[model samples]
Target: MAHTIREKNKLLARVKRIKGQLDAVERALEAEAECEKVMHLLVSARAAMTGLTAEVVEDHVRTHLVDTELFPDALREDGVEELLAVIRTYMK
Candidate 1:
């Protein structure tokens, strides 16, 4: 997907923050922190990962799922089917 420089920077920043969170989770594991603390960190990390995945999926859909212009009405059904197929695969 084509992203403005600003958008790219924002995504990069998010990825970096997720990386840091992952590192913290690792440290918590190594330090034998409380089980609840480690579990909380893991849950947060998973949430971040899910958000990142969603962002990428949205970008992909915007870029490739449906044409905004010159989209043939006759092909709309096919387009919807293709989009649903992709979304199903991605969700899996």
Candidate 2:
């Protein structure tokens, strides 16, 4: 979707951050860090991943579903363009 094209850079940045976090976790394990320190790193990485997942899921819902109450003109009038704009942004 055009949304991906527009957000590719932003998405890639998130991925990169996740990768960095994973790498940190790996190094901590390899260095035999304390259990508490390693757990903290793991938890941080998990939280980042969860945040990314939530963003994508919310975007998907917004892309495929619309609330008429929120956009009465869109549902009752010539508002396909408005919906299409949202899809284009969320499809990415």
Candidate 2 lDDT by residue in tens digits, 16-65: 99999999999999999998998999888888887776566655554445
- Per-prediction CA RMSD (Å): 4.8, 8.5
| CA-lDDT, candidates in order | 0.74, 0.71
Q: Give the Cα RMSD of candidate 2.
A: 8.5
Clashing pairs in 2: 4-92
TM-scores vs. true structure, each candidate? 0.66, 0.66
1-92 per-residue lDDT for model 1 (tens digits): 35434389888998899999999999999999999999999899888887777667656655555554656343465665687567757654
Off by over 4 Å in 2: 65-92
